[model samples]
Target: MTKNKIEKIFKILSKQISNPKTELTYKNPYTFLVSVVLSAQATDKSVNASTVKLFKIIKRPEEMIKLGETKLKKYIKTIGLYNSKAKNIINLSKILFEKHNGKIPSDFNLLTSLPGVGNKTASVYQNEILNIPRVAVDTHVFRVSNRIGLVKTKNPDETQIKLESIIPKKWLKSAHHLLILHGRYTCKSQKPLCGDCVVYKHCSYIKSEQNKKNISSQ
Candidate 1:
């Protein structure tokens, strides 16, 4: 897509949901990192519900290690992959304490090296916390970007690369949230709300549907 079109798409999305931010409730970077780890293949609502009580008591890495993996799993049992995620969280917390002095590292490589902190998680932490312009392509981003003709990629990594290359730097910071919200609410996987979508005009999915309708009518 062209620079102007990309800007228009994001501007409209931003207007719809002003000050778009992560739905995961957390007190600090430590909690945010844990939430992202728990959010793998899980919903933000689920993560928030799980973290609500947990965050009140144990909001730091050292505290998490003290909580132990078993207790951590019990706290996040509602989320998917609770057992493995709990282990990763505990292991990562130990690393945070031993290496970074319980602070979340700003470096992407260092962040990814942590257990459960994949590319998507690292990008999310960087974007929200560090204000880095990294497009974290989750399922929503993958579907929405392709549907909107923003990128014609196969996987999340490809989508991320294409998005970072094409999307204007000005919109990069907010693009992750904008695209994610648009996909989650408007451009859904099963039945998209095309009529209600603000960027329907620019959506290739809508255009394709129109073409099909025209062909059928003809």
Candidate 2:
């Protein structure tokens, strides 16, 4: 995509989603970390449904440690891979309390060092909790970015690098949320709502589809 088109894509999206934020509900960084961990292979809706009551009771790392893995599993059992997620949450909570003074570290290295917290999770936390400008390349972001021709990466890591390099510095903080929302709501995986898309005029996927249709009709 040209720099101007790239800028316009974000401009239109920002106007559409004025108050973009993580859909996962959380009381604080500790809860946000736990929610992100549970969100692996699970939806934000699912994580929020379970964490709604859990966040009310346990608001800190120490509180999560007290809840124990078994009870934590019970709370997040509705989520995918509850057994493993519960264990990682319990272990990471213990580490955070013991080493980091029950605080979510702002440092990317330390955040990713936590169990179940990978590059994507750390980026999301940094973007949302730490107010950092990072592009967390989730499934939605990867698909949307490539389909829109902003990037043509095969993996999330490449997509993250390409997006950060090309995306406007001012839009960095909100770009992650915008791309995710676009993919989740409009530019879906199986079938994108091209008619409703604001940037469809600049969409390579849409143009390619049109080309294919014209050729087939001929």
Best by TM-score: 2
Best by lDDT: 2
lDDT of 1 by residue, 78-155 (tens): 888899999899999999999999899999999999999999999999999999999999999999999999999999
- Candidate 2 has its poorest 10 consecutive residues by lDDT at 25-34
Candidate 2 lDDT by residue in tens digits, 1-218 = 78999999999999988988999998888889999999988999999999998998999999999999989989989999999999999999999999999998999999999999999999999999988999999999999999999999999999999999999998999999999999999999998999999888889999889999999999
Runs of candidate 1 exceeding 4 Å displacement: 216-218
